[model samples]
Target: MGSSSRRNTMSDVTIIGLGPMGSTLARTLLKNGTNVTVWNRTREKAEQLIREGAEFNPEAAAAVSASPIVIVCVANYEASHNILGSHEVAKNLEGRLVVELSTGTPQDARNSETRVREQGADYLDGAILATPAQIGMPDTPIFLSGSEAAFRRSEPVLKILAGNLIYMGEAVGAASAWDLATLATTFGAMFGFFHGSRILESEGYRVDSFGSMMADISPVLGQMIKYEGEIIQTGAYENPQSSVKTCRGTADLWLKQALEAGINNEFPTFAMGLFNKAKAAGYENEELAAVMKVLR
Candidate 1:
């Protein structure tokens, strides 16, 4: 049988929110032939999904009891806790699996797991790494952690929403940790890209062309990062292909160009501060990865 047919034979799901992400999730599951029960604080938000074959449950507690698997996607842990942490909802959670797709810190995941387990339900923390528009695509990723048994129970239904299901072992906090760490790296590069765009604009270059160039060279950039990561992993900061001093010089050049072009220098200034700390600590001759030591 196809996955959709198998899902029909499997357990139903309860979706406990109706925001963009939650609505997309419910729609995906409904498209896959799974019986979906939906509830949101704002009941009107569930209207479209209900018209699309989702059964609407007005009360949060009743929604939790409507399915064997409950997926909670809310703004944050605080909102999720307010919805599911109540005695009425907590009591209905027994013998069911609660899959939390809300964004939160590691501590929040830990606390949510504890609360769910206290109510005799299995809990799995998850982080969806794609936007609402990406849901149900074969390449869409969802990171999950906590309660291997719970994961096994919910895997089929979860796969309807995302194809790439990355189980991060039994640590309830791993999903959130991985998500936040990846976001940090992504945003750090994005800020630098923004600064680069400003530089190109000052030089009268097309920003779209610069973006396309960056996309083309991304593999090369990835390789460079991999090399530095290995060096950092082994603490082999000497015999550098690129030294801290060399990078510092680049930052200095950026600052100089920013001054001449009369543009914002925040990116270069921030970079220079870190390089100066490494230089002051006598890592000037070491590999660029040695800056991690300064960070540590």
Candidate 2:
């Protein structure tokens, strides 16, 4: 039988929340032939998914009771708790596995794990590193951290929702930590790209062309990712091979240009802070990664 056929043959999977991400996940489950029971605060949001073969339940407790695997992708930890903490839902969740894909701080994830466990449910914290469209496609990275046994038990179903799923150890907080770190890197790189694009546009250059050219630099980013590990492991930011001072000068020039362009200088300004700190610390002659110390 196909994966969808196998899923349909099984019992059921329940989902809470029907936002873009939640709806996408539900759709993927439905396509895989998994019987899905869904609940959302606003009932109207789930109507489309219901038409797509999902069973929409107005009662959160009924949804939880209908499935062995309960996936919650609400707004945050508090909202997730608000939905699941209902006495009826909590009471019916015993013996079920609850996988949370909501965005939250590491501490929040840890706390949620504890709270969910208190209600006699196994908790697994998950972080979806892709947009709605990428779910279930190859290369969609998802992080999971919690009970090893619980993860192993749900891996088969979870694989249907992630292209690249990683088990991030047993700490419920690990997935959230990875999520936060990854988001920071992604946002930082995007801000840099946006700043660069704006600067080029101000100079009458085609932003689209600049973006296409930048796309060719993906390999360079891969190298930078490797260097990040070296920086973390060796605590050696200063690359004696390529003086940090040289990098500082380039950063200063970029900052100056940003200021002159009347652009929000937050990105380069923050970068300059690290470069300036490293320069003041006498690591000017070190490699660019050496500036990471100042950043930390």
Number of the top lDDT candidate: 1
TM-score, predicted candidate 2 vs. hidden true structure:
0.92
Candidates' TM-scores? 0.94, 0.92
- Expressed as tens digits, the lDDT of each residue in 200-271 for candidate 1 is 999999999999999999999989989999999999999999999999999999999999999999999999
**In model 1, where do residues sit more than 4 Å from their true spots?**
1-11
Q: How many residue pairs clash in each candidate?
A: 0, 8
Reference-based lDDT, each prediction: 0.92, 0.85
lDDT of 1: 0.92
Total colliding residue pairs, candidate 2: 8
Off by over 4 Å in 2: 1-11, 259-264
TM-score of candidate 1 against the unseen true structure? 0.94
The residue-by-residue lDDT of candidate 2 on 212-262, one tens digit each, is: 887899889778778767776887754455567887787888888977887
